[model samples]
Target chain A: MKPKSFAYVRPDSVEEAVDLLAQHGEDARIIAGGQSLMAMLNLRLVEPSILVDISQLKELSEIGVRDGAVEVGASVTQARLLAWPELKARAPFIALALPWVGHFQTRNRGTVCGSIAHADPSSELPLSLRLLGGEVVLRSKKGSRKVKAEAFQQGLLTTARRPDELITAVRFPVGVGAEGAGFREVARRHGDFAIVAVGAVKVAGSIRVAVGGVADRPGLLELPAGGSEAERRQAIEDFAWELGGYDDIHASARYRRDLVRRLAPIIISEAA
Target chain B: MRRIERDEIVSVSFELNGKRAAGTAQPRTLLSDFLRQTLGATGTHVGCEHGVCGCCTVMIDGVACRSCLTLAVQVEGRRVETVESLAGDEDRLNALQRAFNKHHALQCGFCTPGILMSFTDYLGRNPKPSEDEVREVLGGHICRCTGYAGLVAAVLDAAREMRGETEPEGEPHAA
Candidate 1:
């Protein structure tokens, strides 16, 4: 399972990194923390002609909070986010979900923006981004654009980011009174990729729920304006039906729908 | 910021077992292979050659990470502590290793190095971890021999030894 031969480069600045990516386009792949990319590389699942290692870019490693928004840089590791007290104070749900992202070791090097960039269907980072109302900043030599989490994640293992674009950072608006938030996922093992995961938080005054691994991308369901607990749960069940699921070796579409139907209310209630 | 051509060999220098170790590896070579084949530090075994197995766990710059997932060239100027560093100059077993023997924490012995390295790193920060905390740390690893009962005991025992506690009693899983 050795990887194919590939050229390697480490750009010192974000601009230079983007320039290199623009020069290579689809032939180049960016490696930030190298947690997920290295595994894929070892398995030969992806073979880029040029490998751009961005782990050394100092500009992308700093975590900043401005205008009441937490901006996680592309090189910010998952462990680094968990270490920041502001993250827990600003968004408790993200803090709760970080521990489940991976094991202690992988978290030490796995980047939050890298997880978002990878766009795994069952990942907790993407679900947290969507439920908390986050934005992904994509940059290229052409210019830059901010895409919401809902739109940035295009499909399973796919994103709205172009080949030449570099995800400079991702910003999640601080939770206003985001207390009592909760996250849970059912995985075969603690560190294994989740079969189905749910993330919920109190945004403004309403409880927003996002379900992962049930469809091509994590979906944010619209709750009724006002209803009893049972009625809201029924709406969630119906919403689960609208989310498209497919049969795979891990779970059947029907089973996944049931999981969403059962998991949504529990997590939403916990967030309350 | 050095750029290399395709399949170019690069020299990687890192602190291994508190000493400088230098070797040459292609960009694709994993740190686990570099330690075993290049440096002859086979104590870091590769069970799955993937991140899940945890058999290749080591201390990189004081943080425990799976060597298989880390590229060899990535360890440039980094400090690495393998299982070989656990023993003293006289080759005496460390407290954790001694506890594992007393508690029957290992049978196949393939998963011991990773578990020891992981617990060694964990116990350093948390000298007195509770059972649930230990289990949470252990959850990151997989052992097919069903030796968890003994493994958990070894961790708690090692923690007690580190904390300088009195004669310790093993948990229900203790051998």
Candidate 2:
């Protein structure tokens, strides 16, 4: 099937893109790698009147470590990040999760910001971001604002981003004074969306966890510091309850909950 | 960095199989359609019409990507290698194509072009891949026929040939 005919534009700068988005609103769709949006467009699931191509925006192509955080420009593809020594050193979770995002080819064209913006409950990037306490930088014609990854992801395929805002970049706080970190996921196929994805970062005294694909949004949990094995077991069980999993074609709600119950310890143990 | 107004004609020019090809497409025109309709490069087959099936896979600037998931306009200045890029002359078959024929890696031949384009990129990067790694890459592709036993052999054989190694005498079976 062909996508409905629409206009396409590549803005000279982030501001110009924001103005176009602001002017067009719902009729406009921001396109980066086109890995996700193109699927929707080809299926006619989303038929925007305009597609703003940000892939060529040089301003949004930088990946750097600054002020204790790793900043990835909106146009930076996942494959590029996977090869970046700085990102792997500063934010180890990204390195661990990227290969699981999609196949090698999709990663070549899929942007990190696009993944975060897609906000799929099954997306590995956002699950990792939420666990690491990242921030999304959104710009509008008026100005820019930073929203925590937690607050930005609203629900399934939904985010808090306003219609007029364009995601310019994302900031992930690099784990410091950390003991270890690990990421794991189970998909029917190697590159398919996960049945459940877990990312864990163990710091000086405690374990932090984030889970995706079991609910409308990824769930974050901080287990109590330094507890007995039983206490930790109970803590994980209690945390699992908060996920609000629902039945879907992939797996039942109980199965997803069971995955969290089982995988939580293995990944936490790996990170530890 | 550039601005295009609504419903405006966007001329896209890119290297298609080592030759310059240019076309005008609506923003919605997919690269798969561009190759078939504009350049008459029908060798790159389209299936599933989405990213799930690797039937529309092509080399975009040397990376394997789904042509169905890419707009024709997006190939503006990139190099796209379709299945047509494989063989040099009408009489000669490329090493990969020959290996596929020898190993019986394809049936119905619908999935061959996309698989070839994909491996053209994959085998270049991983000239030596373990069976698991080959299987891992194959996970992205769907093949109802040949069961991939033959495809893996084809890739391994092609890799050896690409490395300038001569095929050992007699019907060679993948070890």
Candidate 3:
């Protein structure tokens, strides 16, 4: 099946891409790998008048350690991220969930920033990022700004990004002391979107668990460091109640809440 | 009558099967359609249009990708090789292909091209991958007929052959 007709423009630099997006406003879409956007276009879920192909922009395809953190360019593919030695060491959570992103073929073309920008509630990257307190760098013709992962995603498939903005990079802070991370998701089949996914990171004296696919956006719960078993159990119940899962076609809200209550403690215990 | 000004279809020149070729296509046309319809290379099949069914797999810049989902124009100036290009004119199958044939790994042959391309790329990268590693990488390809036992043996056999081991005699077939 052919996609709807749309104008295509390949910009040499991110500045040019941002300008094109600004010119087209909401009618323009920035495409890095075209992994998610192409599928959306084929499904007619979105009809952008112009597709700004930024895949050739080498500046946005880098992975480097800087400022006591690791900054991954928006165009970095999931496959590349999985193979990145530095990222595997610096952010083990990203590594733990990288295999679950998609099949190797899909990961070959899917970009990290594209996944984050899509903000699928069931996606692994967003949930992991939120749990690790990652930040997204948004670029526009006017300037650039950063947003915490927690605040970046407003709802399912919804983000704080504007029509004229492009996600240039995602930064993960260093020094998560004594941190152990775990990512687990239940899906009907391997490589399928998760029915419910959980990413938990335990650092120093605190624990953070981010639940996805059961809520509109990734829901994060913070447990005090070195809590008693009773306190931890109470926190788990309170977090489950706070989630207020939505009933969807995949699973009922009640089932999701129950799973969260059941799985959160296990993940927390493992991390702890 | 209003006339529709045809947008210019960009000419994309790339190396396919070690030969330089060029074609003009719409910006959004997928690589699978370009290969099958435009270039008349039907060896690559499309199973699930989504990326799941690896039937449309092809080597783009030495990496396997689902041609059904990859835009053809994206491969401009890049080298692409399909399953048809795996062997020379002698009709001799590559190690992986020969292993697939000897092990009777394929039932309907619908998923052979993708499986071949993926395994070929895998062996190129890791000639000595463990059994679990093979499963980890090839888990993306689905074969309903063979139940993946024959496919796994084929990969392991190919790995052994690449390591200069002669083909084992009367290899165990899928039970």
Candidate 4:
């Protein structure tokens, strides 16, 4: 399971990295902690001519609040984000979902922006970002642009990210007053990819529910909080049907829908 | 930035188990392969090189990580610890290893190295972890023998022993 031959470079700055991307275009691939990309490379799923390593770029490793949103740099590892003191107070749902991203071993080397850039349909970070309406910061040699999470993640293993663009950072809105967050996923194993994952956010008498692993991408639904239990279940059921779960080796479409219908309400209650 | 060509073999240097180690690697050489094939530290076994199986786990800068998921060039100038570093004073097992022996945590022994390295890093960070937390960390590894109960017990026992909550039980060499 060896990766195909590829040249490797480590850029000192984000600008240099973007320039490398622009120069190499689709021939070069950006690697952060490489928790996901390395596996893909080993599986021969991708055969990039060159790899740009960004893990050592100090400027791309900061996790701080900027303009009322938590800006996580491209090099910020999942373990570092989980250890961030402001995480629980800022984006609690992300904090809850981070533990389920991968095993402790992978989390030690996986980058937050890398996961979002990978755009795995069943990944927790993208699901949380979508539910929270986060922003993805993409930078090319020409300039930088911010795309909303929903637009950034286009489909399964696909994204709005261009071949010549580098994801410099991601911005997640800070949780404001009286917000509640909860996350739960049913995986065959604890560290494995989720068969069905659900995240819920309660804010200002409204619940935003996000479901992953059942659709082409993580899907989000917003519902008023005044509904009765039966009504809430019906709304969740409707959302599940809307997702149109597909059959895979790990789980069937019916099982995934059943899980969403069953777990969404419990997650909502947990958030409440 | 210096770019190493795909076919070029570059000299890579790093601290392996607290000592300077050097090797040659191509850009695509996995750290697991480098450690075992190039450096000849075969204690870091390779299984399911796609990072699902935890057999290739090792410590990079004191954090547990999948070596299969890491490039050999990435460890340049970084500190890496493998299963070979666990013993001290004439190959005497460490506390965690001793605990595993006491709990009969291995039958095939292929997964033990990775499990040992993982818990070694884990116990250092969480010296007083609960049983559930231990199980959660154990969830990272895939073991076919002993059904993880013995592994879980060993981790908890090792944690207790490391925390000085209990004395070493029986003979140190007993199985």
Best by TM-score: 4
What docking class should model 2 receive? medium
lDDT of 2 by residue, B1-104 (tens): 55556567778899998889998877888999999988788998888887887888999989998899898888898899988888776545678888998889
User: What TM-scores do the predictions have?
Assistant: 0.95, 0.94, 0.93, 0.98
Better of 1 and 2 by TM-score: 1
User: What residue pairs are clashing in model 4?
Assistant: none
Each model's total of backbone clashes: 0, 0, 1, 0
Model 2 clashes, total count:
0
- Candidate 1's C-alpha runs over 4 A off are A176-179, A224-226, B167-175
| Candidate 3: regions farther than 4 A off | A247-249, B1-7, B165-175
Residue A265 of model 2, lDDT score: 93
The local distance difference test score of each candidate is 0.85, 0.86, 0.82, 0.92
Writing each residue's lDDT as its tens digit, candidate 4 over A1-272 gives 89999999998888889889989999999999999999999999999999999999999989999997899999999999999998888878888899999999999999999999998989999998899889999999889999999899998999999999999999998883237888899999898999999998987889999999999899999889788888888898899999999999989999999999889988998887
Per-residue error (Å), model 3, residue A150: 1.2
Q: List model 3 lDDT by residue over A1-272, tens digit each.
A: 56667777778788888888789889987777777777787677888777787776899999988886678898888888888977667887887888988777778878888899989988988887788888999999999999999899999889999988989999877645237887788776667788788888887678889998888889999888778999888887887788878787778888888888878887777677
How many angstroms is residue B75 displaced in model 3 relative to the true structure, after the best TM-score fit? 1.0
Evaluating just chain A, the predictions reach TM-scores of 0.96, 0.97, 0.95, 0.98
Candidate 1 overall lDDT versus native? 0.85
Rank candidates by TM-score, best first. Answer: 4, 1, 2, 3
Q: Which stretches of candidate 4 lie over 4 Å from their true place?
A: A176-178
Give the number of the best model, judged by DockQ: 4
Q: Interface Cα RMSD per model, in Å?
A: 1.3, 1.6, 6.6, 0.8
